[model samples]
Target: MRRSPWSTLVVLAIAQFMVVLDVTIVNVALPRMQTDLGFAPDDLQWVISAYTLIFGGFLLLGGRSADLVGRRRIFVAGLVVFALSSLAAGVATSPLELILFRGVQGLGGAMLSASALTLLMVTFEHGRRRTIALGVWGGLAGLGGTMGAIVGGVLVDNLSWRWVFLVNVPIGIVVIAATFFIIRESRAIISGRRTFDVAGAVLSTTGLLAIMLGVIRAEPLGWGSIEVIGLLAGGVLLLAAFVLVESRSAAPLIPLRLFRTRSLSLSVVALGLNSAGFLAMFFLTAIFLQQVRGLSAFDTGLAFLPMGIAAIVGAVVASRFVTMFGTRAVQVVAAVISVIGLLLLSTADASSPYASSLLPGLILFGLGITAMGVPAQVAAQSKVRTDDAGAASGVLNAGYQVGGALGLAVITTLATAHITDAMTGGTAPLAAAVGGFQFGLLIAAIFAAVNIVIALLSPSVTVDSATATEAAELEPVAI
Candidate 1:
């Protein structure tokens, strides 16, 4: 049953990369998908949201499933489901069909993502091996932004958007086969008789769906709209109810007690804020590059390659710095560095050069993100029972999804309002609308700075993996 740690890392990273890459690959293809599928501008959001919302909403359940069933089995099952769904999506003739298939793909993606980390944890023994693995996993998440831009442009421009989905087919087959051969499976041990938390799952999932839907609709419908208000309210109430139910449930899908760790609580908050800034920054910058700088799609993708490479390099360095610099110090310093990057990004104008103005911020942001995210991820999963890796992973992923959703809403609203105000008296072209996006980058920088403040105040942060619990000591992969 033994497998080389390297084999396990490679398999898990591929799966994780696919899951994360999907988050952005569709960005460049939105226009083509709409034209071919007849999806309206508004409806196109679902192409992205459908995948993320389901993936985020069901992540907790998926994590728990991995523990109860088996990590390796669920992992492979997820890939099969994902691959089939991708094929369905690639060939879909209608928006509705594509959306449905996208949701299915998200479900499988959630399951695969939920198990991948736990397997990585169990595959590599605690100590240096785990750290390197974690660095790889964490690094890949950051690299997704750059890769998505490049791959999306190539596929959309040269071939077709469908390649984004079809490309997954071969990759999925290879990863699934390699995983089966290289990964060891683990199952959760239950005490006496335990029941699944059906009520808790229903409440939380519905609650999250409501909140996510409402948040995403804020810009289109206006936050003041009754429908948006109602959904948000209902989401908050259902989440509250879920918490109450979890308190009394015999076996909660999400262990409420995990929040007892000071480090875990702080890390999640930091992760969310950091993600908010990170996601919004890219959306804003891409618009700036294309609309403002007049860069071609291919050029935009090329512009991002450096940031991607820097992320991997920075993450490996950050992981090593954990023990020497101390996790908390690195976190605070990293947040500050990202803030500086965000600050630099805010200065970018139509006349600024990419190499000088943008590169500095991108590099700083890359380094800071790698440092903060990797450590926080390691910290969040460090104390939980190995069986709860899925839950732990889901929690971190939730922060990521929540942050992105919240950021998208906040930035879109702010940017639109500013742009609309400036052009209210005149009929401005699409360029004026794009100007609004630049201000969104400024707002995103503000959010990044907020994360820095949060990191600065969290004196409880520690990076020594030993400080994390025995079962939770598995290293993070930069993937």
Candidate 2:
């Protein structure tokens, strides 16, 4: 059966949006969930961290599985798991149950998200069609975080915190039903080789999970505490071992050779840095609007609508710009724009007005992030072999999640320290909080500045019309 490209894109985009939305949707509902479930102050962090740890840890494995098993099959399976787990989360009567269900949701998200990108890459030709498809993909990706807050607020305020998880049930079911009709199954060709590298998967997944856990715990545990140090050290050592295992494996989970492509390597680095700043902005901004400005959840979500709209517009513009110029040039320009936005945000204080002080910076930040993200995604996937498409997508996403986790931890620590110092100096509580947020914004600007340097130093690669056409025609090869 033939499928319309537009239909396929719509279905996949919905799935991707749901997965990404879950990341931030819970933030607005956290207080309610804690109160309802009787969660401890420290344990509440687990609601977010649990999902992140599993999602980041298993992304590579999930991507590789999509290549080895089948893209469409894995995607459907992921949706089922996601929907079921979401249902469980909604009905959870205890904190442990909610956390457990969230972890399962993350596992499903990893599988669905990795497969969705690989499927998109294969479904559309790599020319103007693919570029446009990725533009929509990038735009939705940017909007999901912002929209999560919006949608979450509405659901929590009007209904209950449970609605945040319950909402995914209907969306997941629709995507799953659509998948059977609109998506085609594709997998890497395997000869007599082993289907997967078990050792590599275990080592890599455990290593990444440890690293994420360590970072998430660092703020609460004290960065220099023995537990944090031990976790970080163990994670690094395991990752080193995973490198050794992959270097020699006949069927490695993530091909080490992929990094040899300069565009792929640099794009991954840039994506990580950009995500670090992007997510930190979302986190701190939400806190500032609510805690400092005294906005209701509904109002805070409304405040972000302009930024979400701007991100979609920026994504469209980025696609056209990438088509006209090149990924390297567009990325550099985008990073510079993001730095300017972050600096503008650093000027915010307790008395700053939303329209005058916040809106302008939010617009620039939204535009710059989507612009940077679209090109980076396109560049990362440009040079990969068809058989390794899933792996490439997974690695890129893993970088984003890992970078976000680390960035949030580091920036939060800096903000907390600044707030304590300011309070000690006799600053009022509200003033101290605003000052800390401003400090975090400054550090976030530094992260974006690093992205600019990376963009400048990265090798230039252009996807012209002719080259894109050639890439579109390339077929999968049997291993």
- Candidate with maximal lDDT: 2
Instruction: Give RMSD (Å) of candidate 1 vs. truth.
Output: 3.8
Residues 262-285 of candidate 1 have per-residue lDDT tens digits of 667777788777766766676566
Instruction: TM-score for candidate 1, please give it.
Output: 0.85
lDDT (0-100) at residue 439 of candidate 2? 94
Whole-structure CA lDDT of model 1: 0.72
Candidate 2, poorest ten consecutive residues by summed lDDT? 470-479
lDDT of candidate 2 over 345-449, digit per residue (tens)? 888777778787888888998788877876777777788898676567667767776666666656766777788778899999989989988999999999999
lDDT of 1 at 154: 86
Q: How close to the true structure is residue 196 of candidate 2, measured as C-alpha lDDT? A: 64
Evaluate all candidate structures by whole-model CA lDDT and list the values in order: 0.72, 0.78
How far in Å is the alpha carbon of 121 misplaced in model 2?
4.9
